[model samples]
Target: MPGGGAGARRRGRPRKDEPALTERVVLDAGVRLLARDGLDAVTMRGLAAELGVRAASLYRYVRNKDELLDALADEQFAGIDLTRYVQDDWRAALTAMATALRRHLLARRDAARLIAGRFTTGPHSLRNIEALLTVLRGAGLSDHDAAFAAYTCVTSLFGFVAAEQNRLSAEVAAGMAPREYLDRLAGRLRAMPADRYPNVVALAGELTAPDLAARFDFAMARLLAGIDALVAAGEPR
Candidate 1:
């Protein structure tokens, strides 16, 4: 019994070698739970359990579920590549930012779901926002238009990514291939009588095309074109 201390081991207590729980550790566990299970599975109690800690301990780092979600949303912004944001070309800068944001959101499960509901002001989020505003201002946008463009870009990203995720999830749950699912959708649209739904019948294939990248680029091109027109018009501040 020289090295053994069997009697000293207590139930439900951390081992002497256990790492201390910090906010970052808690957030990491929360993200893992979200990715492995989904958004609804990331409650305080569940996260505590995932970390093998008491539920009350999590409160020391994150007071509640809302704070956790906000922190997580901010954390997702950490992965964006700000270096690629071109300063001289506002359109290029914005397009790069938007594309990077979309990629980051879609990389994690339910990332957009939580981010859409939370307004994060963490350092990473603020840095990205600052970059966006700078580009807008450099493009000769008024303060109001800069604000509007920033909000519009972020909201559009959230909406489009959320829709893409939902569609992918639905396809997975239905046990169908992506192309098969789109084909089925196209068929359903084409089935409607041409007399009643001429446009829909005529463009069913185009409507249900699975080219999300092309569609997203087209949408952003149109939005940026409108903003470009506003800049050209020299709208009053």
Candidate 2:
């Protein structure tokens, strides 16, 4: 029984009690969707539905899904406590940062894949890069070397996390626990012909150990050793 013009106007207007939508709100909704349904579920339309708003409304905040993902990556970087590295030795600082990044990405589903290889110029990401550069420069690396080192460290961290996630997914799809799978894999390695693969057969247990933490630590130590050697060799700026 409502009049067409007046009713349409009333419906179009936001109520005083309604909360105003902001960029943060849109990003937050996107985060929740990413967490619950993985990165593939995050889209302008999906986020709008979650927020109970029109998809066009989200464009005011983020131009597209790629921008929204950059924001989410920025959000992840913001959680890292860079202050804790203020007094840390250069190696310790890098290790802490890498460890924190890996843990953060692993905590969210598809988080590593979401942020990996995406160049984000957002505030949080810039801050993290600056911190890394500072750490490398503090360790006596020249300006150019520090920049390259920082880039290497960040890319390595992202790459490692992406690979780790893939391994986890494969394990899940195979319907076998990680340890069980590793044990079976080790057994197969041990069965290989000694003449053709002596070293692999001889170290099957070490190669297929289920201790991801230990393996990660070992690899990180090796990477740091190489960096330290480069710093010692004083590679030209």
Candidate 3:
């Protein structure tokens, strides 16, 4: 009877040799699921299975899926190397940061979508914001301008990356090469009534520019130029 009860206990409970289920372990597993599969694959049960634990166990760390997603977004931010974006020139530093962030978001499946609309309070997220603010302030921006610039840059990054990912996925889903899709789109734009839409008919190709990276660079350059003008104007007296 004693041996039978011990065997039953062992069957129902986790083995002593199994790894402990900590927040970091759960978050790491979630990252793996998100990267390997996608945002949809990061359910509590799925993550628990990935970590060899029960679904209920994950609640010890995260309250729900939304909390898990917020944590995962923070994890992605944590993975970014802020030092890599550091530069003596503010424009160069911000450019590097934006470029690095785009690449980072694209590296994982649905990473950009996962981060969109979530305001994480994790240390990594805070550090990233602090770093951006520091860069803007160092560039001689007024406090108001610095805050505005930081918000603008972050929102632009997320929106741009999300759109980029969605476009790529759409192309893949439609079974068309990206260039082919762009060409088709350009054709449609060019066929518009010239009198009604002169610019759309005239510059369809440019409108559907194939080089998103170059476009992103152009955008950042324009943003920096505007900031530079503000700096030249000197804080509003």
**Top-TM-score candidate index:** 1
Preferred candidate (lDDT higher): 2 or 3: 3
Tens-digit lDDT string for candidate 3 (92-125): 8998888888898888778888988777788888
After superposition, which runs of candidate 3 have C-alpha atoms over 4 Å from their true positions? 1-20, 168-171
| lDDT of each candidate versus the true structure | 0.79, 0.75, 0.79
Instruction: Give per-candidate clash totals.
Output: 0, 0, 0
Q: In the order shown, what is each candidate's alpha-carbon RMSD?
A: 8.0, 7.5, 7.5
Better of 1 and 3 by TM-score: 1
Q: What is the lDDT of residue 231 in candidate 1?
A: 92
Where does candidate 3 clash, by residue pair?
none
Q: How would you order the candidates by TM-score, starting with the best?
A: 1, 3, 2
lDDT of 2 at 149: 76
The lowest-lDDT stretch of 10 consecutive residues in candidate 3 is 1-10
- The residue-by-residue lDDT of candidate 2 on 7-27, one tens digit each, is 222323323444567657777
Model 1 stretches with alpha carbons more than 4 Å out: 1-19, 168-171
Once model 1 is optimally superposed onto the true structure by TM-score, how far is the C-alpha of residue 219 displaced, in angstroms? 0.8
| TM-scores of all candidate predictions against the true structure | 0.86, 0.81, 0.82
